[model samples]
Target: MARIMSGVQPTGNLHIGNYLGALVNWVRLQDQYEAYFSIVDLHALTGRPEPAALRHAVREVAIGVLASGVDPERATVFVQSHVPQHTELAWVLTCLTPLGDLNRMTQFKDKSQHQPDNINTGLFTYPVLQTADIVLYRADRVPVGEDQEQHLELARETVRRFNHVYGETFPEPQVVKSSAPRVMGLDGESKMSKSRNNEIGLFETADETMLKLRGAKTDPARLRKTDKGTPEVCNIYSYHGFFTGEVQRAAIATGCRSAQLGCVDCKKLLAQNLEVVKGPIRERAAVLREQPRRLEEILAAGAHRARAEAEKTMVLVRERVGLGAPRS
Candidate 1:
């Protein structure tokens, strides 16, 4: 099986956007590929999160990943910092990466604008580290959202540059696009993110989820209960496309267009469908949280597996780049 690698940052609680956009796909892909999924704690550092909060977030994100059905036995699941070779390889790749490429990255520009006071080198070179994260595993494919397409392209370019200079040391990883590539937040104007406070947490109780849904933005054209709504323009309807069945989604769409389903009723239906998926995940996460030792063991085992693979790649990289002592 071709190897695929992907990761989630331990920045905040995993949300429904995460579930539909990434984690759900990760669960399905595990059986078809040699999968490596990491809680990328190193990447999370750019946000300058509090030390204790970061540690707590990492554990919580691990629970979220495991509870979402990413089996440890099927996929190598580890913390990114646990294997030092990621940053080690990142430095090597960073040297090969062009400054112009980093400058052109829209994400870097957006992030810089978001945190102008803290525009550090790490923020600028984020893509280079991401390139290292994938190629360090010699991952043949990477599951990426629409937002990361540019970064993946850069990864491919960096790999090609390394190959041109040092021979074919790594494969150019291909993209495995998610089914729901860009899940909009409840605001319906931007991507779902914890920073925006527009996300519904994956582990939230049914009541909590429903409360958020109640205030979610729908079609602006929808003026009242009897007004016909456009499901295509409604973020809630987009959500139904992911969580709700085809038959029900079609019914919902018809109901929406016909003014039969009010926004409140529509949101309630979405809340119910969401619970069908998240309820089990939340329960599983609770069990994992109660057993912190078990979570550590899984992460440790995964790191051991990941480190072994990373070392193999580094050995070749060292030899190719003439980094280590001369071979006798």
Candidate 2:
């Protein structure tokens, strides 16, 4: 099977957009690929999270991944910090990467501007570390969103530069995109994000989910109950490409255009449809929460497994770069 690697930052709550866009695809991808899914804690540090929040968020994100059905038996699921080679290799790749290349990255610029008060070196050099994460396992494919296209391309460039300088030790990674991506936030002004207060947590109770949805943005053109909506432009309808079925979506579309349904009524239908998907996930997460040791065991085992392969690659890399034999 072809190896695939991807990661999620343990920054905040997993939302509906995350579920439909990323996590759901991860679940489906495991059956077809040798997957390594990681909680990218080191990557999150550049964002400058509080220590306690980072710890809690990392564990909670891990819990969410397991609850969301990233089976350890199916994929290598671990934290980035567990495997030290990720950093050690990152250092090597950084040496190969050019300053001009890092400066040109758009995400780096955006995130850097957002945190102008504390623009750390880590933030500037993260793309190299990202390359290390993918190339450490020699992953051939990575599932990515539109926002990550440039970063993925940079990772490939880093791999190519290293191969040209020190001989080919890593393969360039490719992207696999999702078609039915969840795009809108609770505010519906931009992508779902914690900073924007536009997300519904994956483990939120049914009532909480409904409450969030009720307050969320929908087509503003249909302010009155009798007004007809264009489901084509509505975020709620956009979500249905994943949450609701073919028939449900068709009905919603028809109802919206024909003025047969109100926004409240449409939201009610989506909330109900959501339960059918999130119900089992919530149950599994609760079970895992009770057995916290299981998460530790899985992570330790993943680190151990990942280390073996990463070490082998490092040995070969060291020899290619004329670092000579391993110390006795």
Candidate 3:
């Protein structure tokens, strides 16, 4: 099976957008690929999160990953920082990466504007590290959302540059696009994000989920129960496309257009469907949280497996780049 690599930042609680966009697909693809799913704690450092918070978030995100059905038996679930080769390889790639290319990255520009006071070098060279993350594993396929397409392209270019200079050290990784690539937040203005405060947490209780849904944006034209509305324009309905079945989705759309169903009812239905998926995941996460030692053991085992593979790549990288002998 071809190897695939992907990761989620250990920033905060993952939400439904994460589930629909990445985690769900990770679960599906694990059996078909040599999957390496990582909780990228190193990448999360750009925000300068508190150390204690970061440690807690890492375990929480790992629980979310495991609870979402990414089996440790079938996939390598590791923390990014645990495998030091990631940053080591990142530095090598950063040297080869063009400043112009990094400057052109929209994400870097956007992030710089968002955190103007802390426009650190890491923020600018983020894509270089991402390239290292994929190529270090020699992952042939990378599952990414629409927002990361530019970064993936940059990764491909960086790989090409490395190959040209170093002579075929890595294969260009391909994109594995998520079915729901851009899950909009409840606000319907931007992508679902914790920073935006428009997300429904994956581990939230059913009542909490429903409360958030109640305030979610729907068809703007929808004024009263009697007014007809377009489901296509409604963010809630779009969410229904992911969580609700085809038959029910069609019925909801028809009800929406015909003025038979109110936005409140529609949101309630979505909340119910969402619970069907998130409830079990929340329960499993609870169990994992109660057993912190078990979570650590899984991560330790995964890091051991990941380190073995990373060292193999680094040995070749060191020889190709004329680095010093392997450390004792």
* lDDT, each prediction: 0.93, 0.86, 0.92
Record all residue pairs in model 3 with backbone atoms less than 3 Å apart, i.e. clashing.
none
Ranking by TM-score: 3, 1, 2
In the range 188-243, model 2's lDDT, one tens digit per residue, is 78788776788877888778889998987888898887888899888888777778
RMSD of each: 1.7, 1.6, 0.9
The deviation in Å at residue 244 for candidate 1 is 0.8
How well does model 1 score by local distance difference test?
A: 0.93
Error of 3 at 204 (Å): 0.6
Worst 10 residues of 3 by lDDT: 319-328
Model 1: per-residue Cα lDDT over 47-163, one tens digit each: 889999999999999999999999999999999999999998999998998789998999998888877888888998999999999999999999999999999999999999999
The regions of model 3 sitting more than 4 angstroms off are none
TM per prediction: 0.98, 0.96, 0.98
Residue 139's C-alpha lDDT in candidate 3? Answer: 98
In candidate 2, how many Å is residue 156 off?
A: 1.1
CA displacement after TM-score superposition, residue 284 of candidate 2 (Å): 0.8
